[model samples]
Target: MVDPSPESVELARFSLWRSKLDCAFGWFEDAERTIESLLSPQAQNQPETLPFMIFIEPHLPRMEGLELLHLLRSHPSTQALPVVMFATSYDETDAARSRAAGASDYIVKPVDAREFMQVVSDTVARWLPVGSKKAD
Candidate 1:
């Protein structure tokens, strides 16, 4: 998770706990750290270093989400990594921009907890195959 909001991180963790998805994650409120982690040399070769899924918020602390996504896609190490953009905005234009840059999906933050959980469940089930260990 690459969101600056502690609530988002906590909510994600809580959702994971509630769902019992059996996955591990790292959260970076700062985009710079997220980029560093993704571009690290060991990320490609080390199973523990790679992420099963990456969730990014569109409005980051420094760079915008789309810029970061573009950087990730251009990098050889993270080009194929599955990335999901979860944003508060309901604008279709932003969603379209994210999709055009090779994002796996763009989801708006739900107002209801149940709806968010359902979305999370669907995202995990749809993106990560039953037996996958290094995709998200």
Candidate 2:
């Protein structure tokens, strides 16, 4: 769930809708916005009540985004969260850099529905905690 601009939000939203896997996705234009919402009590309740996988797009400008990712991966609470990056091309050096930072996976954008669903299914299968399950 990596999206920084409104256009990115739209793209991710569309990709998510087209996915055949049962999952949950949320977006924020910036890191601070995502943090604020995620820190709230409502967000805390989500893990227990809804029991869905989370995909976050901190979407900070390159440097800032990297900083945010570092912070998240270093922080005790979110360090092991199942995060991934998405972009126009998987060839970008920066995407690899992001993986080095902490992303569990990365996806190339303009994803066809089939490939997109495959990625979603694969991520869920790999990341969802043992004994916990998603309805889809």
Candidate 3:
């Protein structure tokens, strides 16, 4: 996950924990760290065969999620990876742009824990491998 808000990350982490999913996570508030994480498998503790399903907010620093998604698509290491756009508001233009840029999905940031959990459940169901600790 990548967002410019530590509080948001913390809340998401807490929500995941409360839902009883046993997953490891790494988060970033900046583009550089996110890029580094994508480039280095060891940094993320991920096997080389599995690509990351990135959850990134649309409104981020020097490189917004849309631009970053394009970059990732172009880069050999991250090409074919799944990128999910997350934003506070739903803009058709942004959604279209994300689709054009090869985003796997676009999600509007939820205002409450329940909504966020629902999003997580949907995301895991669609993108994660089977047998993942599903949300109740």
Candidate 4:
């Protein structure tokens, strides 16, 4: 997860935990740090350590999510990873741009807490490997 909002990150973390998904999660408040972490020599040396999926918000303080998505798509290590771009509200142009930039999905964040959590859980579940078991 690469959301700048602490609330958003906490919500996502709680949602994943409550869903009982056995997965590791990392959060980045800015795109530059995320880029550095992902494109570092250590990361390049061990591509397998890269994340299976990434959830990013469209608007960020430094580099925008779309720009970050483009960079990720161009990189060999993260090109194939599923990228989900989310926003507080739906915008046709943003959705189209995200798809063109190789985002796996685009979602409008729900204002309702429960609905938001459900969306997060469903999205994560959809991307999980087949036959994946819930955390005990």
Candidate 5:
């Protein structure tokens, strides 16, 4: 997750936990750190250690989510990774930009806690293997 908001990270963590999905979540405050970690020697040596998906907020402190998405797409190591761009409200322009930048999906975060949790769980499940318990 590349959101600086602690609440958002906690919410996503809780949602995944409630759904009984076993995923190692890494929360980064900015795109630079995330990029560094993802491009590190360890991660490059063992690609399986990379995340199954990435959740990013459109507006971040440093680099914008769309910019980060472009960077990820430009890199060979992260080109195929699934990146989901999200925001507090629906914006057609942002959604279109995300899609153009190669984001796997785009979502407008739900206000209701339950709905948010459901959305997060469902999104993650979509990226998991069909028969995996994580997807169930």
Candidate 6:
């Protein structure tokens, strides 16, 4: 769920970074508009789905979207979903506050390819079901 810029190149790069997974993309012009869409009825009911790890770009235009993390955490339907936020920069205090607000984790942007891969892999690994094994 780590949405960078809407650039296709960025999306492709991210896709390539985790090519082995059954990855799908969800888009919303704003986070608030997308929460329900991303967590559609079908998606929520999937039995084999992995723990959701969202990478949100909080720097964009919609401030309400930023409130999405709190809203998701507050709602029972999405309360346990693991979310990871990505941003180019944030004041340390601001980042700390975001954590307090309920983001599972945060990643600073301009991430190198290697680090990006590792982070995504590690996050997915940590969040995956306990008896599950990594996809080959």
Using all chains and alpha carbons, the TM-scores for the candidates as numbered come to 0.87, 0.62, 0.81, 0.95, 0.92, 0.69
Give the local distance difference test score of model 6: 0.61
Q: Can you rank all candidates by TM-score, best first?
A: 4, 5, 1, 3, 6, 2
- Predicted structure 5: clash tally: 0
- Candidate 2 residue 4 C-alpha distance from true site, Å: 4.1
Q: Could you say which candidate leads in TM-score?
A: 4
Q: In order, what lDDT does every prediction score?
A: 0.81, 0.59, 0.76, 0.90, 0.87, 0.61
How much is the lDDT of residue 61 in candidate 4? 89
Looking at candidate 1, the ten consecutive residues that score lowest on lDDT are 127-136
Cα lDDT of model 1 by residue, 1-136, tens digit: 8999887777777777677677775799978998777776666566557776788899998798999999889977678878999997677888999999999999987978777777776787687756753333
The Cα RMSD in angstroms, rounded to one decimal, for candidate 6 relative to the true structure is 3.7
Q: Rank the candidates by lDDT, best first.
A: 4, 5, 1, 3, 6, 2
* Model 4 poorest 10 in a row by lDDT: 127-136
Give the alpha carbon lDDT tens digit for every residue of 72-113 in model 6: 787666777777666667558657767888887776654565
**Against the hidden true structure, what lDDT does model 3 obtain?**
0.76
**Window of ten residues with lowest summed lDDT in model 5:** 127-136
Compare candidates 4 and 5 on TM-score and give the better one.
Answer: 4
Per-candidate alpha-carbon RMSD to the true structure? 3.3, 4.2, 3.0, 1.1, 1.7, 3.7
lDDT of 3 by residue, 1-136 (tens): 8899887677677666776665666688977787776766564466453444677898898888887888778876677777888788899999999999999899887988678767765674477656776556
Give the clashing residue pairs of candidate 4, or none.
none
Top candidate, metric lDDT: 4
Q: Tell me the deviation in Å of residue 103 in model 3.
A: 0.5
Clashing pairs in 6: 1-55, 2-55
Q: For residues 13-128, could you state the per-residue lDDT of candidate 4 as single tens digits?
A: 99999999878889999899899999888889988778889998999887899999999999999998999997988999999999999999999889888889889899999988
Model 5, residue 5: C-alpha shift (Å)? 0.8
Q: What is the model-wide C-alpha lDDT for candidate 2?
A: 0.59
lDDT of 2 at 42: 70
- What is candidate 2's lDDT per residue for 1-136, written digit by digit as tens? 5456566556455645564344566666667765556545676556543323444443456435566677667755567676766555555676777889987776664457556555655666677667655455
lDDT of 6 at 59: 64
